[model samples]
Every structure is written in C-alpha cells, then in structure tokens.
Target: MKKYNRIKLWEGLHSSYWFVPLLITGAAIALAFFMLTLDSTGKSGLMEKSGLKIYTGGADSALTLLSTIASSMITVAGTVFSVTLVALTLASQQFGPRVLRNFMQDIRFKFVLGTFIATFIYCLLVLRSVHTDAEQPFVPKISITVAILLAIASILVLIYFIHHASTSIHAWHIIREISDELESNIDYVFSENPGNSHPEHKRQLVEEITTGFEQQAYPILATGSGYIRAIDYDRLMNIAKSKDLLLHLKHRPGKFIVRGSKLVRVFPFERGNGKLTKEINYAFILGRERTAFQDVEFSIKQLVEIAIRAISPAVNDPFTAIRCIDQLSVALCHLTQREFPSPYWYDDNDQLRLIADQVTFAALVDDAFHQIRQYGRQEVAVTIRLLETIATIAEYTRNKNNYVALLRHANMIRRGSENLFEKLDREDVEAQYQVVLQRLAKI
Candidate 1:
C-alpha cells in the first residue's frame, strides 16, 4: 500500500468509536485466559507467598465478586455510550457536523469507552471460571484480583471522561482545537521554500512546457462522483514517468467531481490506454466528504463555519466569532512565513512529468475569511477584528502577493463597515484599517 493510503486506513480506524474497544476487548479476553492458566497451574498462590494476599476467597465468594463487577461495568459502559452520543449531538448542533470528527477522533473518549467494555468482558470471563458445585472446585483468584484492579481503574477513567466530555463542548475549546489543527496542517503541507528564486520564472517555465499539450492531450474522465479526498502524487508521477507521459491534473484535493468529469489530461494521446486509465483512477481516493488529511481548506472551512454560525442572527455571539478570528489570524500569520510547493513535478532527468493543480495563498485567505466578512459585515466588532486579523497577517508576510490579498480584504471590510457602523464604531474600524495599511507598507 502507498504511504498515504496506509495513513488514511489508520486514520479511519483511529477516528472510529469501535476500533479501540475492539482491541481492548481482545486484550481482555487474552488476559482472562492467561490468568486462568496461572490459577489452574497453582501459580496464583505465588502472589500469596509474596504477601500480596489479594482476592483469596472461595469459589462462591469469587463468583459473587466477579458477578458484581461484571454487572456494574456493563451498566457503566452503557452510561458512557449514552453520554458520548449526547456529546456528539451537542457538538454537531453547535459547532457544525464536520466538527464532530474531532470528538469522534478524541482518544480520551475512545479510551474510556474501551476501558469500560473491556472491564465488563474481563469480569464475565473470570466469572465463568468460578464453580462451587463442581467435583473439583476452582476459582481463578488471580483473574478475580485483576478484575478488581480493572474496576478501580475504570472508576478513574469514568471521572476523567466526565471532565473531558464537559470541557470539549465549550466554544472556545473547539475553536482552539481547530486552530491548532490548522497550524499543524500548514506546517505539514508547506514545509519547503520555493526551489526557484522567483516564482514567476517557474510559472513561465511551466507554461513553456505545457504550451501546446492542451490541444493534443487525452482527457481522463472520472468514473465516479465524489470529493477528491487525497491524490497519490508519487503513484501518479511514477505512472507518468514509466509510460513516458506528461499528466496534467485538472483538480486538486477537496474538489467535487461528477461522473464523466475531466480528471486529468495526458500528453501524447497515442500512448493512452484503458489500463493506464484504471491505474490513474486508482491513484485518486474519493470520498463522500472532505478530510483534513491533504485538504487544508477543510480545517479552514470548519473554523469559518463556527464563526459564521456564532455571528448569525439566532446566535448573535460576537465573542465566539472574535475567538475564531483570533485563531485564524494565528494560522494565517504562520502561513505567511511558509512557502507553498510548486505545482510542477519533474523526473530525475529534470523533464517535467506531472502538472498538478495547486493551492494558492490568496485562495486560502479567501477561504479563511470571506464568509465571515460577508456574514459579519453589520457587526462592528467582527468587522474591526477582520481588519485587525489582516494587519496581524501583514506583519509576518514579505510576499507582495500576500500583501495584495491582505489589503484587498482590509479594504472590503472598510467599505462594508462604512455603510453599517455608526460614527464612533466607524472610527474604531477606520483606525484598524489604517493599522493594516501601515503594517502591509513595511518591508
């Protein structure tokens, strides 16, 4: 499997509610058998020799204790499941459905669920071994003791889970979590500086290479319709390099495609074959919804969703919107200092093999704030914060294009505020707009 495919598979498993519980339950089963082995072989008496003296009761007492633990654990497990569902519902309603992915992927919630289930299963398995009416009475003392310890540990997990579920639903916590994720994704995606000293020089080179290929290249149409969750760049480039083909990608991750839509354009139409089409299709992973794996815009959209909802007429919570803006500013500032990868890909021979669609800084800025500005225009505080965010981003950037994008948004905010804000509020916004201009003016 490819690296990203493996990562995606793991991510799918990790984000699920059942995977951890399944693993923990499996471990619990294995542990039950192991403890039974020790007890049947008379090895459990070693703990008593070591002065541990834990759970040294008879078969009837062991049965009663294990039964109590098992029943209590199953009940608590049900309670945890109910609480988790409630939390998920609240998160979806308040933070948008996309944000529920964060709660689903939370390790604490999964661990608590797993611990309770595993404890229940462990107690049941141990309870099955206790028999008072048998010819040779037997009680797995060690297993019963471990069950007790697990019960105690489960109580602590329950307490921690209660705290986690409560705090995780708070607006500020959700906003900060997404902000942290956005910053991390920026670092992951845009880690390298431009290879060429001038970006325009590289753009010209790309245009030169693909000058007449558009007319002659064979177009590859998508077979299914969905959002492009991730593209296997290495696989795509390898297929192009091996077949001596030049592939031009028509869309990037996060783009929705319809059946029969153009997915890629292949140069030298004579070399295009059905097998090559299938292989190329195999390199793209489509899904019902967008993911943050390679699509940084998905995270940006989540924050924007929260901000717009907060500023809506029903919510009218500018403070939450401001928190979102603050977090977005932090991410944008970090982004301003990073370099985006070029869309052009070359082989070892320095011959261009792939022309991939790329994400631009301007597109990202628009994604991060355009909707917020549109929705929050009438709100003076949100408008001023929008301009202030631009100013903050301006301080970290040296790129001319970044300055232009920031200035454009600042001017738009200024224009919107002039029509909506009263005299005193307009002065506050105008002051922030001037600060943005001054910041962008610096070297």
Candidate 2:
C-alpha cells in the first residue's frame, strides 16, 4: 500500500476537481465492460433469470438507443462545461479571482461533469457489445438498462446543476460559503487546548533562537520563488533531532518567498553538514498559490475580498458589506476563545530545534476588516457595522491585548468616519463608536 501524508494528500485532492472523478469515470467504464462480459459468459444465472423487461429490444435497437444516448450525453456534457465557464467568468468578474478556487473546488460541479462523462463512457462501452453476429446476436440487457437509467439520472442532475449554479453566484451565498470555510479552518487550527495562553514563553523562545542564530547559525536561502504552501514539521523536527541543530524558519505558510531569500537559519551552522540544507528545503513546500492548509489568513482574506468588492463604487452594496462584517466578527470571536499554537517546536528530548512564524489575533483582525473599512468609508452603515463588529469581538474576548487591538481598530473606524459622513450619519456612527468604547470599558 502506498502511504501519503494525510494533510498533503487531502490538500492535493482539494486543490483539484478532476482526479477522483476521472478515477470514478474510468471505474464505471470498466464495470460496465465487466458486467457485459459476465452476461456474455452465461455464468450469472440470476441475471439471466431476472424478469426485468427493460431492454426487450434486439441488438440493433439497443445499438441505436445507446448511441443516441451517448451522443446526447456528450452534448449535455458540452453544455455543462459551457455553463461552468460562464459562471466562473462571472464569479471572477464580480468577486475577486481568488474565489475561482471555490468554484473549482466545488464537488457538485465536478460530480455533475463526471456523471455525464461516466454515463457516456458506460454507454459507449456497453454499445460495443451489442452485435448481430453469425452464431448469436448479443445484447447486454442489464447494461443497456443501466445506461438508460443513467441517462435519466443525468437529466435530473442537469436540472439540479442549473439551479445550483444560479444560486451559488449570489453574493449572500458566496459570502456564507466563505464564512463557513473560514469558521471550519479556525476550528481546525485553533480548537486544541484553549487554556494555553502563554505568549511570554513563545517570546522567550523566539529571543533565544534569534540570539543563538546571530552567534553561530548559517542562513539557508530559498532556491525558488513562490508562496509557502505547507511545512512538514514532523520531518523537520526529526532532522533537527538527528542533526542536533536548531532551525529557525524565516517564512510561514502563505508567505511569498523569492529566490535567494533567507528560508531558514540553522544554529551551530557546521552541524547541518551541507546535506541537511537540501532536506530542510524539502520540508518546505512552495507553490504558485497559497492554500488554507496551515494558512488561516488566506481564508480570512476570501471574506475580505468579497466585502471589498461589495463596497466598491461599481457595486455600492453596503448590506453585503455589513453581512461580511458580521461573519468576520463571529470568526474573530471564535478565534479569541481558542489558543494559538506556539511557534516554537521541540524534539523528543525537549530541545528547541525549530522557530516558526505564527498568525496573531491582531493580524487576523486587521486582515479581516482593514480592506472593507477602507473601501466602505463613504458608507455610514458599513462604518457603524465595523464598530459594532469590533465591539462584539471585544465583548467575547478576555485578553487585554485583544481588547486593545479592537479598540485600535475602533479608533481607526471612528477617525475614518469623521469626514466621510454627514452630520446625522456621523452621529449614528459616533453612537456605535461610543458603544464600542463602552464595551471596552466593561472589558
């Protein structure tokens, strides 16, 4: 059996829409051929005895029917692809291009395409067996019946796909989907050990690593240019343990690194023995795009993109912006309740061997609302909602530093609203600002 890193395998599968469906389509074709072969052998007495009169036609009739269905399937498949491309184009134009990944990762669309192709392949495979030969006229009754059923299934799926495509492009649906994904990613990354809030330990470790690196560490420059997609931490820890060296990573997942950038600094530089540099580089996977595997900020940025698009002058949709702010607040509230993992990694012997970068609450809050706040400055409702979101998050969090960050954002929103709104609109914004301050006072 082949083994794969579960996270990497899942990331690969999630990044593409074709692999699994292609496998399924191939398997369907093989299965159709196998069933037809079994029927030809006259070994399956139960299949022969079954009184289903679905395919009561002769070989010629079956051939004509299957061929027509296969052609129709191909036409429908073409139509589906056309509809998908149109939807993708619209989504890219309306929302940012980052959302193209969402549509591409959509399982429903992939399954619909796969179903049409698989059914067409199945029919084609079974159609080949329908022949009027010299000794026997062969017609795989069960296979033809299955093909007919699949054709009907394809029709139903087409209807569902049309409805789904239309509904999925709506702003609310897109925002909600992004929000759900962000929430799930937050839970996945932060839902362990909520009580461990010792930032001092992490700071101390970072200081020690910095000082150690300055004294004896050697820097490893990046060999290529791309975003850091994932880091194999377990393998890195093992290498660090084996080499008895400390490794300090210069970039985190989702960060872009250019060629010759400092990728990592190894302490006791001579301990790595030159070969460890290649192994260290192997641990860090670079790609053309960022992924949500270890990058929670990428998920946050999706919502921000939608919010920014909503507030743009062409869209001028403040309600959608408010909805995004609400979702961002919910995500930040959940984030505050959870403990972020320490950036420092240790070996089995409790030796600190790796120093990785981490995403902070302040950074997430800024990424979540900064762009929306900037784009929505002219809209009073959006500004008020921004303050309300900050107030809501402040109420949910116990950390003084988080409260400070929320207050800082609240101040920025208040400052931005001063010139953007009329007298009454400014009053409304001021009321929300005071409410946020009151919430902070209680905190």
For each of the candidates, the C-alpha root-mean-square deviation to the true structure, in angstroms, is 1.9, 2.8
lDDT of each: 0.86, 0.82
Q: Give the alpha carbon lDDT tens digit for every residue of 355-441 in model 2.
A: 777788999999987898888888888888889888888888988888888998999999999896379998999989999999899
- What residue runs in model 2 are displaced by over 4 Å at the alpha carbon? 1-6, 43-50, 133-135, 191-209, 346-350
Error of 2 at 119 (Å): 1.3
Q: Give the worst 10-residue stretch by lDDT in candidate 1.
A: 192-201
User: How many clashing residue pairs appear in each of the predictions shown?
Assistant: 0, 0
Name the top lDDT candidate. 1
Output the lDDT of residue 213, model 2. 62
The prediction achieving the highest TM-score against the true structure is 1
Q: Candidate 2 lDDT (Cα, whole model)?
A: 0.82
Q: List the residue pairs that clash in candidate 2.
A: none
TM-score for each prediction? Answer: 0.95, 0.92
Per-residue alpha-carbon lDDT of model 1 for 1-443, expressed as tens digits? Answer: 37767877877897888998999999999999998999899987788898886787888888888889889988999999999899989989887999988998888888898998999999888888888976988888888889999999999998999898899999999998888888887777776331223345556767776889889999898988998888888888889989999999999888999989889999989988788888898888887777887778889999999999999998899999999989888888887887777778878777778888888889999998899999999999899889888988887999999988988898888888878637998899999988988998894
List runs of model 1 lying over 4 Å from the truth. 192-205
